[model samples]
Target: MAGRQTRGRQRIPIQFIESQDDMYATFSKRRLGLYKKASELSTLCGVDIGLIIFSPTGNPYSFFSPGAEAIMERYRNPDQPVSGIPQFIDDHSRTQLVQLNQALDEVLEMKEQIKDREKQLDEADGIRPKGWWEHVPVESLNANQVLTWTTWFENVRTQIRTRKEELRNGAGTSAAPGSTR
Candidate 1:
């Protein structure tokens, strides 16, 4: 009775854990499993593969088939020449290109978001013009269409003046259209 164990090892549940220590331990174990699988795959297929991972604390861990330098050497362009020294410029260039592409995509997405927001703001504020000259083709415009467009411009100018007057009266604002003041 003195040396008898009360509880035997029970099966661990497979589910998400909330504890940080437990999660880190799980991550470490999985990482080892991944490295083992990668090694086995490379050996079985006689293929070169490199895997690099960064932990949450920014520590880097890498596994490469054959060796890291060997894989990296094979990755570079064979036709490229170096002046008696190994140059990693090609890898850096590729990394820079990937970063630039990601940045460009982000910028384009932001531009679209801004355009959508502007459209929504315009719609909410009732800022649409009654007519636009660009809608009619310049080469196809007849005499009557040209006259009508000119009249529309004059009406828009008048509306602009009235709006400016209202703004001036409300807040003593300046910079009215076609004004020196």
Candidate 2:
């Protein structure tokens, strides 16, 4: 593999693997060894390297030093990219944005569930609690509790709407055609 051709004495091509089956076996072994070396380099020298691999069948694999996706994202854009400092910041910001979006989705789902639960509790107790908001302050909420409340609220709302429809229909009130609710 070291005998692979080079364009210049100083500039060596990092891609050492050939497409031949015998070469492929050597490549696989070397790739693992290379990854180990990369890990050592990052840990010892405090350098970040993003290693990407394409197998013989064209499957993809990767390793990231310290912060995984952040390192790759720093190199994702070439032409419009900044050097070093701001690049790392942008990578961190991008990672944070992804995590924020995931959390937002989870909250939205929880809200739906809370609406359902509120309705059910109202039905079961035959009363809506006065000062419910003051009783359960948002600041004291945990994620799991919020999700549970959301589920109950949504289910109860559905039940109330269904009951209201039943009452309206029984009183000979006609809903507009193709409108179930």
Candidate 3:
């Protein structure tokens, strides 16, 4: 007998995922990895890099190093000299905005989860389940219940049989117009 095969990380083809949910999940995971790599590059190389990604759901994501603003300034206007003071101003604002947006998103998600959990608990509270009747093999709990349970079970069986017979008879009548019960 063959043992279970080990399925490690397999490379996925670079192609568009058809499912919307799967696409979003893939985007989030890849985006995170990309950000980490960019961060590592900036730290190790001591170079500035600004990375921007737009999610499939249209959310904007960005990572900026300390030198991000200076780089952007140079890109925008090559002739104009880059200034360190202005770089701090721009980077500070971008940092604050990114932090605020992330915090708000996390708070909203936490609030939503709490609300859903509360609603579920509230609904469950209304059920008020208790007693030996809640257990399976309910007849074991109360000997008196044995007769009642048996009768109830038989009633259900009888109803099912009656319903089946009625359906069969109805179909037979329709199929053969001259037939009468």
Q: Point to the candidate with the largest lDDT.
A: 3
Return the TM-score for candidate 1, rounded to 2 decimals.
0.34
For each candidate in the order shown, give its overall lDDT on alpha carbons: 0.72, 0.71, 0.74
Q: Runs in model 3 with CA error above 4 Å?
A: 1-8, 79-81, 87-181
Candidate 1 lDDT, 100-181, residue by residue in tens: 6579879999999999999999897686554355556778989998798789778878878887787878965656555533
Candidate 2 residues lying further than 4 Å off, grouped into runs, are 1-20, 76-181
Instruction: Please give, for residues 110-166, the per-residue lDDT of candidate 2 as tens digits.
Output: 999999999898797676445564578877999998898888678768967876888
Better of 1 and 2 by TM-score: 1
Residue pairs whose backbone atoms clash in candidate 3: none
**Cα RMSD (Å) between model 3 and the true structure?**
18.5
RMSD of each: 19.5, 20.8, 18.5
TM-score of each: 0.34, 0.32, 0.41
- Backbone collision count in every prediction? 0, 16, 0
Which candidate tops TM-score? Answer: 3
Ranking of models by TM-score: 3, 1, 2
